[model samples]
Target: MSTVLIVFLLYLIGMVVAGIVTARLASKSLDDFILGGKKMLTPVIALSEKGTDMSAWLLIGLPGQAFKMGIGAIWAGIGVWVGSLFNWLVIATPLRRLTGKYNALTIPDYFESRFGDSSHLLRITASILIVFFFTLYVSAQVVGAGKILAATFDINQVVGMVIGLSIILFYTMMGGFIAETWTDFFQGLIMVTALILMCIVGVISIGGLGNVFSRISAVDPKAALLSAGESGTALYLGLILGGLAIGFGYAGQPHILMRYMALRSEKEVKKAMIIAMTWTTFAVAGAIFLGFLAIPFLRGEIADPEHITLAFAAKILPGWLVGLVLAAATAAMMSTVDSQLLVTTSAITEDIYRKLINPDATQKLLVRLARIFTVVVAIIAFFLGLRAERLVYWLVLYAWGGLAASFGPPLILSLLWKGTTKYGVFAGMVVGAITIVVWYNVPILKNFLYELIPGFFLSLIATWLVSLFTAAEQRRTK
Candidate 1:
């Protein structure tokens, strides 16, 4: 096994150093801390958004799915890429303009301002949902870190978890939004480059694309076919639907949405959309290839399929090169957790504490409180990581479904439909959240489909119906 630990150590140090370097940038005001005062450049926002969205799931979870499910796993890659494209094309510019007009710093704040909800109901409900789902999402990232460390270094899972968790909290506390964004941009590059490099090397080692397919086909006849890897047409249909399920979530993610909001100008988002989509093209293809390539080499031997990326890297790459790949995978996890922590903190500090509790709160005080809440949230997530109830993939999907279902319908509809009422959006969020929780826990329902599919559509229906009912009443009142 490749035992070069120094590369991983250096990567962790680099994350903390980024935070220290950006500390001065975060100290000026709440806007600066939360969104870089809307001054981030195009490349920075583009790659950072990609990095935040990819997470360790790109390297760990997706590959694991492809490793186990064969060629049919492409559904997930397609889902994310198409979903992301939709979010950029449809939601980015208008959202930037709306948030700018409202002077809003967080999603909840945007909700209140956009809908003229002076009752604070929209703001509080949105904030509560953000906190609830983001904390779970961050916990999944923490869990990914532990899994990586344990697999790479042969360390106890708890120790590995703590090491990864502590660095993320420290760096995030040190620099806030700008720091994490900058870190994510760099980490994003490392993740893509490493994943692609591994794919190229694996393809070459396997002799050629033809050989790879034949070998995997030798094991399972349908494994090489993109449309179906299992026996029944029914099984193929299930794979496609379940894989595409989470695509609906891209429009709803607060951490990813924040990147769009922080762009220097709305016009720049077009250029950024191209850059980000190009990055996604490379990253997703690499992940999918990695998983497929590993099926011939590591199938049935590995205990945890999610460890396939690192295990395969150790098998093929040199000692130091493997270390670099390990760092890249680790970077994927850190890039995500830091952003989720900051987004969750903003929900607590900016949306709730300042907007609701004390309108007169100073920028410095709110920033301090944000840092404080960042710690509290990280601590809560750390314990959840220790529990390790599910694999990193499922945990992320559940949280993604909740956030997407609850927030996606409301956010997307309000931006597009003038008739969307505050009460309607609130009701949609509640229904969406409830559907995910219920759908995820029941085995029959969970097996029927990916929870996000039902949750999202149901939420959309609730939003449209409730808005139709309430809009006329609101007009009567006015």
Candidate 2:
């Protein structure tokens, strides 16, 4: 291998070692292993949570979209940003309070307690969706890592996938939540550094932001402006709503909300929120800028928008610097993969195996089972990702939509609306899930309608309508 490739491999090895060490320290207790024992401070929780959440899609896919569509893609970030801000401000504090009050360890656990614990099936089904969809989503990240490795070192894509998976799986399986969070903290910092550097280098290489803008205008004037104004009201609203609606997915995601439940206290939530939002804003904004910055430098040679960062860096920077920049993107991908593996394992070990199949299983036994399940899920996801066609952005968006539409309405109502019934929650989940699947598949709907707009609203309406029509005793008996 070349010197640059060798250096990149060494850095990755160090990260893997760090992850294993963390897992060894934190895996003694189930809570500590999966949720960090609810003792995480503000910065660790914030950076780790948001960093894991955004992943490679932010660094690769979003920028690629921006490079292709110009300023129109900024709305994607805007929509997600607005939604996340609302989640931090309106949802995180209450979620932490209630999860703690009920001693809930997962989103499904929160649902079960908040809705009076009448039916465990709700939790089980939700857990199934999380594991099922999240595995597919995690696989996409795996695919991204493979692409990164392949592009970085001229390695085979499959070989890269195997290498990336082995490294990520080592830390994720061994360390659990502790492993994921600490690694995520480090990876998040790397991501920020790389993006900032990419932005700076890209701008300078292209003669600054003004020259960058001027070139884009010279290429496509409409694409250079904010709003793009290309698609018109329906499409714009759909994209914005689709983007912002991503925030709702957090309430349903076991991995992300695991951060909230693990936080030291409610007071920490406030501090974490500020930190998370700031990181998200800068990281995403910088990535979007990097995409635009690549336009002038790359001309038309940056054929695959997704490869803009890698191509641009390789062309402008030295080999060592290029390796570092690629490492940052790898950090983003691994940070997300670790979190997904932990949560996916949690669904099986905590929710399925321990709760349903073997309630009497010892923690030691459950830990073993969790590790087994982690490998099993990762293997399945790796295959699915290889067979899949879409890039990181599309796969991530689909998974995000599914989780949000399925759990968002039920979660919000169970917390705020006293009359939310089990029937209502179930109805919402079923309808929401069906709508998303069907809408996406149907050509007419996919062509004309945003799947989330219909699925989300209809799910909310179904949840309410079902609650109204159900027997009075069916409601949250508070």
Candidate 3:
């Protein structure tokens, strides 16, 4: 094979071996496997958490989106930064305290206990959604890895995906969460380093910032401006708001929040939050700069956008450096995939299988089942990855929208609103979940309706209306 592919294969093999070794060390029990025994150190937690949240979106999707949208794409990163900060500040401590108090191990478990343990149907529904949507989400990460392999080594997409998925799956299934988190920590560092190097090389290649921006402006003035050529104030604000809504997905995401729950103590969270946000800011800034700098070097060929990082690296960097950059791309996808696999497994084993199917299941048995679930989910994701035909960003966003709409409101209401009844939470979830699916399928709404707007609002309204009606009916019966 080509030298680039060999380099990538070597790096990937090392990661897989490391993951397997760590998984053997870490996966003694269900708790250790699923939640890292709730004892991840601050640095480990921070890196793994942030790295898992980023995925290929940071390395590929964001830069690509920025290339396509121009400076307007900066708003998307900013929204994520602000939203993450808010999540750490507003939800971290409370979630830790409450999850510990309730002895809840997963997001769905927390919901079931906090809302009322009368029946676990809600938790089951939530778990099903997590598995369903996350399989699609994980598929996107696999597709990203395939793209990197295809571009870097000239491997076919299908072969690349299989190789990529196998590496991630082997480590995750063997090592579980503990193995995954430590891997994420090292991968996070590599990702940051690669991006920084790319940014530096990219800027120098294009005659510096002034020349780059000037060329971009001359070619696509709309892209250079934040307004994307819109002159109206309302239009600009809407665009910004649209970008900001991305953050709203943070609070409801099981994978990231699971990291918060895994903190050794509630005390570590404040420092962890700072570290995570800072890392996010730095990585996102570097990505945007890379996209901007690429404008001059790539010219018309940058139309694909996602190819900007790889294209620039191929042109500007040497064979070895290019290998390192490709490894970073793999790292980005693996970081996110590991966390997602853990959360998906947790949703199945802890939330549904044990709680509903067998409340008295042993920890050993649960751990075994979790491993099985991890493998099964990975296989499903791989199959779906084979079918994906769109940009990684669009595929991920659709799944993200479904997840945010379905769980975001309920998670928020549970924390802030005491009047929220079990029925109300269920109503909100149904409305939110159905709204996302319907809006996605209905040609009219699918075209014009952003999932967040309708799904979020309808969920909120459903919660309020149902809670009121239930409460009033109870009062009358009394």
RMSD of each: 1.8, 2.4, 2.6
lDDT of 1 by residue, 1-478 (tens): 4356877777888988988898888988989889989998899999999999988889888899888878878999999999999999999999999999999888899998888887899999998988888888888778768877886788887788899989988878878888988899999998998898899889889898779888888776666787655657787788888778768999989999999999988899999999999999999988988999998889878888888988899898887778888888888889888999999999999988898899999988988888899999999988877765465346556888999999999999999999999888999999999999899989999988889999999999999999999998767645
Model 3 segments beyond 4 Å from truth?
Answer: 1-3, 231-234, 387-397, 446-449, 471-478
Report the C-alpha lDDT of model 2 over 1-478, residue by residue, as the tens digit.
Answer: 3656776877788778876677666666677777878876679889998877888878788888788877777878887687678777767888889999988777877777777755587888888888877888888888878878887778899888999999889887887777778778878887888888888887788787678778777877766866664567776776666555555566555567778788888888888988899999988898888887777677578668898878877877888778777878888888888888888888878877766678798777777878889899989988887776374346555677777788878777777787788878988988888888888878998777667767888889998999888747663354
TM, every model: 0.96, 0.94, 0.93
Minimum summed lDDT over a 10-residue window in model 3 is located at 387-396
In model 1, residue pairs whose N, Cα or C atoms come closer than 3 Å (at least 3 residues apart or on different chains), thus clashing, are none
Model 2, position 244, has a per-residue lDDT of 59
Cα lDDT of model 2 overall?
0.79
Query: Which residue pairs clash in candidate 2?
Result: 23-175, 38-262
Alpha carbon lDDT at 175, candidate 2: 79
Candidate 1 global lDDT: 0.88
Model 1 stretches with alpha carbons more than 4 Å out:
1-3, 387-397, 476-478
lDDT leaderboard ranking: 1, 3, 2
Summarize candidate 3's per-residue lDDT along 1-478 as a digit string, tens digits: 3566677778778777877677665557777888888878898898888898888888888888887778888888888898788889988888888888887888889888886655676797888889887877888888878877876677698898888888888888888887788889888888888889998877777677667778788778787888766778887887787788788778778898888889988899999988898888889888887777777677697668888888888889988778888888888998888888888988888887888789888877887898899999888888777655464345566787778878878777778777776678788888888888788768887655467778887888897778777766534533
RMSD to native, candidate 3: 2.6
Tell me model 3's lDDT, rounded to 2 decimals.
Answer: 0.81
